[model samples]
Target: MAADLVSRVKTDPNFIELEAKRGAFGWTIAISMVVIYFAFIFMVAFFKDALSVQVYGVITLAFPLGILVLFSAFVLVGIYVVRANGEFDDLTKKIVEKAR
Candidate 1:
């Protein structure tokens, strides 16, 4: 019974759409994070003087930039969560109902 339902869901057009959307969205977020992280790393490796400059007393430019990298991860997660909770959930519900 479970296998039959799985097969049915796999054949559904909505299931295909859901998988494609999630895959594309997931890759986009992953690539965005990689780009951000590598950009920071490259800056550290090849542009030390720029990141080392003092932004304020006892604080360097690197401090805020590092914080920005962390903040961006959270922002990206929030973006995924919003879409998942909305469109993804709707499509998932449809898939499950159709499968049943």
Candidate 2:
């Protein structure tokens, strides 16, 4: 069965198109994520001093005590997960279906 599906995927133009579409979507997501992560790093470097703070006692000891840095990390992770599980996963599933 698996071999049959592989043979179809190799011979079918539609399956090939779906596979290429999936790859393009995956690459787009990856490149956007890399750009966004680097932009965050650049922002952090440019505004390091702004993030420096001495909070009341316990919070002061914690790293990235600033709200900006914490929220930035949270938003970045949220974006990554949403994109990965939503767009990329859907594309991959479609490609698999086409292959079969």
Candidate 3:
């Protein structure tokens, strides 16, 4: 039964489309997050003095940038969840129905 379902899934066009969409979306998000994360790292590494300088009276650039990195992670996760729950889930259901 499992093998048959697997064979069906492999042959299904919806499954192919689902894989392509998921892979593309996942890679795009992953690359974007990596760039954002590495940029923050590079700034901290190369411009520590600049980041350490007081920005808003007492707050430093590092503090805000750190918070931004954290916030961006949450935002990215939310984006993935929204796409998975909406478009991805719909595609998944269609694939499953086609397999059955």
Winner on TM-score between 1 and 2 is 1
State which candidate has the highest lDDT: 1
TM-score of 2: 0.44
How accurate locally, in lDDT, is each candidate? 0.96, 0.63, 0.92
Backbone clash count for every predicted candidate, in the order shown: 0, 0, 0
Clashing residue pairs in candidate 1 are none
Query: For residues 10-89, could you state the per-residue lDDT of candidate 1 as single tens digits?
Result: 88999999999999999999999999999999999999999999989989999999999999999999999999999999
- Checking candidate 3 for backbone clashes, the offending pairs are none
**Worst window of 10 by summed lDDT in candidate 3:** 91-100
Query: Model 1's lDDT to the true fold?
Result: 0.96
RMSD (CA, Å), each prediction: 2.0, 6.0, 1.9
TM-score of 1: 0.84
Please provide the root mean square deviation of candidate 1 (C-alpha atoms, Å): 2.0
Q: What is the lDDT of residue 5 in candidate 2?
A: 73
Greater-lDDT candidate between 2 and 3: 3
